[model samples]
Target: MIAGRMALGILVALEVAAGCRRGPAPAEPVKVIVTKNGWEPWKIPARKGEKLVLLVTRTTDETCATELVIPEAGVNVPLPLGKEVRIELTPERTGPLRFSCAMKMFQGVIEVR
Candidate 1:
């Protein structure tokens, strides 16, 4: 009886350890909204060397899509009318990078720290 009880306890411990190892890791994707004036929540914070994805939607037709610019990355993406665009960025350093619309009327910043 004593040996049987010990074996049962070991099996329960092993099951609990296996369950913990199979759990998923936590990862939350950041989201931002683009508006006629500029990027809603324009200032965003990201860790250096981390990958970030930006979903840019044109709320108005006044701003040309081609005008969107990220000088630091040399990325110029055009925004189509009434459409959502995705931009991916990886911060190589800790600093603020500027992103603006073609006419330079709409602007925002991405802060990597």
Candidate 2:
């Protein structure tokens, strides 16, 4: 009975410590501008398992990057010219997540660590 009580006490302590611990802080919103050159800041950085928010705005109609596609994340969305689009995703693993246009012509990389 004494051993059982000690185990229970340890479990309670661990639970309390876990409850007091904090997760990674919420990331700041990243703004990506789509010009004729394609997605600006083509290389993005992210942390695995952390929520990432992107504020994407397209400023040109001449580019073929009329849409954003992230195949691995199952994301496909249109980017209307001169409008801001919010994209939220969490990197499940550490690697390069590729985002490209509908035609796969223009591309960008999200480096997750």
Candidate 3:
């Protein structure tokens, strides 16, 4: 009985150790709202070398921010009215990256550290 209990304990310990070796957890996507003024929470915080996902949703039609343009990242996507657009990017450097409307009328920044 003692030998059997020792084997079971060793097996349980190994299982627990394997379970702790998981990879990095996925980063939570940031929800951005487009209003008449511009992107809500215009200042987004991001970590360097990590995947950044942006769930962009346009809630108003009064603004010229019908598209998102990230010149540095070479991302230009049209924003459909009342729909969510997913934009994923991995920031390689630490700094402020600008995103704006097609006409450059509205702008926001992603602050990476």
How many residue pairs clash in all the candidates, one count each? 3, 0, 0
Q: Model 2, range 36-74, lDDT digits (tens) per residue?
A: 999898999998878777789999999799888876776
Candidate 2: stretches off by over 4 Å: 1-24
Error of 3 at 15 (Å): 35
What are the runs in model 1 whose C-alpha is more than 4 Å off?
1-29, 64-66
Between candidates 1 and 3, name the one with more favorable TM-score: 3
Model 2 pairs whose backbones collide: none
lDDT of 3 by residue, 1-113 (tens): 45643432211111122235446764898999999879998999988767677889999999899998876776788899999988877677788878999998899999989
Error of 2 at 61 (Å): 0.3
- Alpha carbon lDDT of residue 37, candidate 3? 78
Number of residue pairs clashing in candidate 3, backbone atoms closer than 3 angstroms, sequence gap of 3 or more or interchain: 0
Cα lDDT of model 1 by residue, 80-103, tens digit: 766766666666777787778766
Lowest lDDT sum, 10 consecutive residues, model 3, at 9-18
Every candidate's lDDT: 0.60, 0.78, 0.78
